[model samples]
Target: MLILGAFNLFVGRLYLIPSESMEPTLNGCAGCDGDRIFVNKLAYLGDSSPHPGDVVVFRGPDSWNGSYTSQRSRNDVIRGIQNAASVVGIIAPDENTLVKRVVATGGQTVQCRAGDPGIMVNGKKVDDEFTEKPMSNPVDPATGSQACQGPYFGPVTVPQDNLWVMGDNRTNSLDSRGHMGDELQGTVPVENVVGRVEAIVLPFGRTGFVDNPDIQHN
Candidate 1:
């Protein structure tokens, strides 16, 4: 028991899906709850970074909030308890953590076309079949205003050691595309990544290894 607990604390951990941002890929959409996934915390232990198409959990920057909101605000004590539980994987961290898929990595240009099925990385179009919905430019949910008339964005270049990430349910996700004007042009630092989601281990019907789409560009 002690060994298992230690392993869960350091090597692998569990996370519960909380929103529909990832949709069909992760089961957190409206009318559907998220899945319980196993995160391989040790996947990027050394001088490595997440590859494009890798599903990862990371700390959202100040400009970004996590995929979903907590049911209700918790008092400081409760919040502290929740954080403790999250460390051991008993519950998902509801703070500034987000789950997204890598769209592009350092030195790559990523763009979304108004009429294209998926965004392009390094000029190579990636029409991911795993995506629950086609990619589209995100809109401001609070005011129902579109950032641009069309869901088209620039061929923004990812910075060194950073990653551009998105959600599977592109239409509803507030991902890198939504934060283009931010300091890092919406690219997240590699250091913020928690781990790569390896598989869905709960809910027998949906248990399986998560697929890593081939999004590499030569």
Candidate 2:
């Protein structure tokens, strides 16, 4: 694996689609009659920010920590396998990075309900057509995916330096909704987010950056 070594442009960090988390938007099977995508890690390197519906790749938390990446225990070996699966949205991130929609940002107030499929941001309706009913796929291992009949909820405000994310496939994702811990509930550290998802490079016809309707409706 040598050359000028300028970030391995040709063989980009390949992600084998493995989950139904972002379904109807991005396919999970690396070759499941679907498209492939490339994660441009450099997209957020400059003084930029992420927007809604941008599919992304990030470094998840202690879910893996020293165990997986380290030459440590037996679980670490298992973690290594799980961690790779997590990267492609296959495993449900007991310790993993996630790809999701940046629904609410730094200072916005977002809310939803299990009764209505519309999201309310700052008291406004965001009835997203992209938001779909919980889909069933055996690829993911998260409990929520298997148990939910969503349209999730909460009338909380985005934390000062946190993000509120949700998966496109509502029923099968455990995002900001389940990402709570008392005072740390409903928020993800802003820095924890790595960058916005840029494009899909696989599945021949669907090759290009991910696209979605604008966050605001006319």
**Candidate with maximal lDDT:** 1
Off by over 4 Å in 1: 1-5, 66-80, 114-117, 133-150
TM-score of candidate 2 to 2 decimals:
0.67
Clashes of 2: 12
lDDT, candidate 1, 192-217, per-residue tens: 88899999987889999997776774
lDDT of 2 by residue, 82-103 (tens): 7655445443444355677777
In model 1, what is the error at residue 111, expressed in angstroms? 0.9
**Each model's C-alpha lDDT?**
0.77, 0.60
Q: What lDDT score goes with residue 55 in model 2?
A: 62
